[model samples]
Target: MRLLVIMSLFALSLVAARPDASKYPSRYDTVDLDMIVNNKKVLESYLKCVLDEGKCTPEGKELKAHIKEALETYCAKCTEPQKEGTRFVIGHLVKNEKEWWRKLSDKYDPERKYVTKYEAELKSIS
Candidate 1:
């Protein structure tokens, strides 16, 4: 019984430590923009996690990955409103982006490339 209990706790800890990254927006295709945008709580939670300005937890990193997946997806059915809404959310999430840039100054503008490309896409929505 004692051995079983210890093993159970170890298993549980491993499970708890694992990240729960979303599996939607499969690699070959896009997901519904509304599916991500309309889910207000999830969107807010992800934004908060990514923008926390602290050491990122696994969950936060997972959320950022999922958000990136959504943002980069090629949803043909996506509407202008959904795109605008996503841009709005992302803009807020990256509002203090100078800090992010400072952290990545040595990376040769990886963040800038993504942000600038996305900004141009957003600009074409009108």
Candidate 2:
């Protein structure tokens, strides 16, 4: 009986730690991804912000706050448009900004685990 209770507690802990597919904040979802991607300086600034090499704007800070979790959950909490925007931004980076992408991977995916976990949905855009 004690063993059963311990197992049940462990299971519950695992479930609790797992992020659910709830909505992330919608405020920044409206940010102009096209402008960011097209403007080399703007995109580099965001990369530096995430890598902790430069100052972060409010949006950059928000992005930094959520990046690890978003990667861990494959953006499970992102809204539909947020997911699409993620694909758009990432596709642009992989295609055009290999060096920045490498820096981002080193910081956020140091274990080399989560960056490539994009699966087919992100692949379709790339």
Best by TM-score: 2
List, residue by residue over 1-126, the lDDT tens digit for candidate 1: 000000000000111121333222222122233343356554444334444544534433533333433333421222333344445434332343334323322122345544455446546763
TM-score of each: 0.32, 0.76
For candidate 1, give the lDDT of residue 122.
40
Candidate 2 structure quality by residue, lDDT tens digits, 1-126: 000000000000111122343655566555667777778887767776667788977666666666766766666666665666776676666567767666666666678676666534447744
RMSD each, Å: 14.2, 12.2
List ranges where model 2 is wrong by over 4 Å: 1-21, 119-126
What TM-score would you give candidate 2 relative to the actual structure?
Answer: 0.76
Off by over 4 Å in 1: 1-33, 53-60, 65-113
Clashes of 2: 0
**In model 2, how large is the Cα lDDT of residue 24?**
57
